[model samples]
Target: MIAIFGSGETSPAMTSVHQELIARVSDPQLNAVLLDTPFGFQENADEIATRTIAYFREHVGCEIRLASYRHGGRATALEFEQFLSRLGNANYVFAGPGSPTYALRHWHDGAVRERLRAKLRQGGCVAFASAAAIGLGAYALPVYEIYKVGADPSWTEGLDLLGEVGVRCAVIPHYDNREGGTHDTRFCYMGEPRLRLLESMLPEDVLILGVDEYTACIIDFEAQSVTVRGRGGVTVRRRGTDRRWQRTTFALSELSHPQVAPAAVPDSASGRPEPDGTDGSPMVEQAREWGAHGRDALDRRDVDGVVAAILETENVLNAWAADLVGTDERDRVRAEMRNLVVRLGDLVRGGGREGVREYVAPLIDVLLSLRGEARREQRFKDADRLRAILAQCGVEVQDTPSGTAWSLQSQN
Candidate 1:
């Protein structure tokens, strides 16, 4: 059940979109659950939830569960798990908008992850708004860091239940209005530097799906089309081999049936697993082979080849994620997989620019080593310096009486 929606930054449009989706489902009598992943003090969260419930009750004759996490505090893994379990029984689930990083940090591991996966496996339809939509990819670029947080934008790991897929896309929520004036223009959301940075991070083959505000790229799996349901068209960008971006625009209907063929198998001995069942013939086998090839290319640091392999593997995985897990778990896994990609990116790019911006495991090793060898004054100075360096690398250091610990800063 592939679906997408956008309502700009307004609550009314969002509420309407929710109602429309619930009404569109085949079974109006089935229960539709609303999972609110709102940021702190979200004024519209309750309204959106209430309207969604009303729509479900009045139109669909169903109940709605307005699930919300604690504000300014991380939602426990157990809470997420319960939410996913509820989703498994839901006819539809809608994710509220907020900080993608915050929502992810809360739901990455444990029962929530598993439950989401289960929902997707069961082919449950799901909808995501704003941050949740951005987070619904193999990787999510935290654009809020540049736009709202006034910090260097960086990518974080997302749930990987989506497997090895990367949209490498940038979504601009309100593409129509210059409501924030020139100072806060749409260009601010798609700054030149950020576009360049995103280009540098992605392979040439990765496609950028840019959605305008108030518009949505509604993907229909059964129909194999991506119809634009709102007011804007989808923008596609293909960075050339010469490191140049080539931009083009396609009406929503044009992308509704973009041609994408099944993957082909590589002519190698150590290929991917072959299909055993009669139903799983050429296409499935080819995808498995491509996945193996992609994994090998990744190990060899063949960026272009790895990207190709990932794309092919993703095509196969999308079906797997959609059919086996449903949309919610697929979305969750996509987030986790993206987090892995960020880690992979760090490895590919020879570690991050910030010296202390290594992976958690390596950073912990370095900190432990430094802490072990320091004299009294040296210890203080080294710890302070390390903390400062970590901060510059987007890490927050907390020195408790027992020991020092760290966490990634809020990506806004």
Candidate 2:
């Protein structure tokens, strides 16, 4: 089985995907490993590895060891063999985020590509995202070479891992990125113009398998089918035309033959009712959903999630405002937006982001208790050290007659 994530491999969005992958393993303890070669060249490779490991252990509730094969040429013979042995032996392997060209070159130099294919053949699960995902197709897009270095769009040899399941195509992650703002940044930053040229460069039979951000295209070879899940879905590009399949499952063989593929069905026709069944506008329902997300995030004290929900709700309102239609749905959505804004205001009062305080209060209280112990023992330096650490984090501590109080410093 293979899981290709367009983005957010280790983020809150993909937590369920990781959980699904690890849960499939029969072992009580997951025999999982992270292949770190993709982003191994970074100065903070160790930090990345640590954070990724922590995310799995804490967020995903699984244990994953690292197969630290940074660069093939620089690695010792023992290190190279250990990396392969670990990857081959593990039932689940994960790799994500880096330069596609660098990963291809590293895989080619280290001969790790064959081991990956062999593992897949043996029914092991290989979940890849971003750069690692781009390298699994019949050909890879040299993302940095073309998007960063001003080189012409061209194809580089890929590991052809998708070919193992009879999907003859190139994998393009970030298929729906809008980071270009006024400009187009879709198709992994190749944009439409360069992307069109690159599409013309492909072989006649090979199509393009474009995965949108925060989406997963899971290919189950044993089942001979493919499933799409997440915020967005798969975009199949064939012969200069594009087809979108969202939250749908299709036979894996249809990818190569392009026959019997299903088109997107409307919610009403597909037995799925509108969110409220009263409003015809999808944006109104979307705003309601994002507003709910904001409330949930506020409850959990997830600062980023709350902010994202608020911004998304605002975007929905802006989009609806541009429309000429007037309805009560819009007013209801406005109420939802106003409620979210009021919640946001409550979360950032008394000159600090109280959301952070709500999230960290228990830990802060524990630390202060430790400081109190140090003070009682006359270890003034240790107590001062604790206070200084909090100060560095913009947490002002005050010792009052009642108790200790702490507040985050205002950036403004």
TM-score of each: 0.50, 0.68
lDDT tens digits by residue: candidate 2, 92-191: 8899888888878878953587778876787778999998999989999999999999998899999899988888889999887655554666788877
Supply candidate 1's per-residue lDDT for 283: 31
Candidate 1 lDDT, 1-412, residue by residue in tens: 4344443422223345455655656363555666666453467556656755665555444567866553425556676556666766776766646677777766665565555555455555566656666665555667677677777765666554333222334443333323333232332264434555665676444444455555565554434444555544444444411111112323333342234333232223422223333211123444556656756765676555545554554455443421211244334333333333443444444533353234244534444445445434465765565455546545566768987677766443
lDDT of each: 0.49, 0.77
- Among all windows of 10 consecutive residues in model 2, the one with the lowest summed lDDT is 265-274
Question: Whole-model lDDT for model 1 versus the true structure?
Answer: 0.49
* Candidate 2 residue spans exceeding 4 A from truth: 27-29, 259-412
Top candidate on lDDT is: 2
